[model samples]
Target: MEYSEKKALAIKEYFAGGTTSTKLGLKYGFGNASVSRWVAMEKKKKRKFEEYAASIRAVREGMPTDVKALQEELRMARLNISLLEAMIDISDDQHGTDIRKKAGTRRS
Candidate 1:
């Protein structure tokens, strides 16, 4: 059975929040494999997972936006990240313990 894109996306969003496919399948009345496939397909459709996830987040928040709007929002976010990283760098210099986690470091 074919599901609507909206339904597939809703399932994908829930799955992203650490929900297992088997549980989601039982809740949504579909097979576990189907839930997995739907989530995988949604992820596979976009090249950049982070940006795709951001767009999905925006949509879920009830704000329908065009590509231009998304682009502008992304730009603003990048600027905010730059500002935050600068602040973190400054704070780290003034502190004893490392504040920022190194890339690929396992959480202890």
Candidate 2:
């Protein structure tokens, strides 16, 4: 189900009023994890709106873009993606599980 920001804030406020996540989630017909995530977001004091960290413009003035070159690059990117996905599939078959970027397993 889709949750609204207003509902999230209300849930957060309910949490602030000493209500547990599980209880609030049950009352609101959502999972406790969702309630906790909402609370965490509310606790983080940051800008309400999202803004780009870098320029939104694709290319700068006086820099011309080539259509054929761009198309070739896109084709190469798609091929690379397919290759990576196949590799992952093979690795999963060999390992019996996804070994790439396993949760809670960090490289030392």
The candidate maximizing lDDT is: 1
Q: Estimate each model's TM-score.
A: 0.35, 0.34
Native-to-model Cα distance after best TM-score fit, residue 53 in candidate 1, in Å: 13
What are the root-mean-square deviations of the candidates from the true structure over C-alphas?
A: 21.4, 23.0
How many backbone clashes are present in model 2? 0
lDDT of 1 by residue, 31-88 (tens): 8898878777767666478788999997977655576689899999999999999898
**lDDT of each structure?**
0.76, 0.71
Best by TM-score: 1
Report the lDDT of model 1 for residue 15.
53
Colliding pairs, model 1: none
Over 57-80, each residue of candidate 2 has an lDDT whose tens digit, in order, gives: 344322345666788899999999
Model 1 lDDT, full chain set: 0.76
Candidate 2 accuracy as lDDT: 0.71
Tell me how far the alpha carbon of residue 31 in candidate 2 is from the true structure, in angstroms, after superposition.
Answer: 0.2
Q: How many backbone clashes are present in model 1?
A: 0
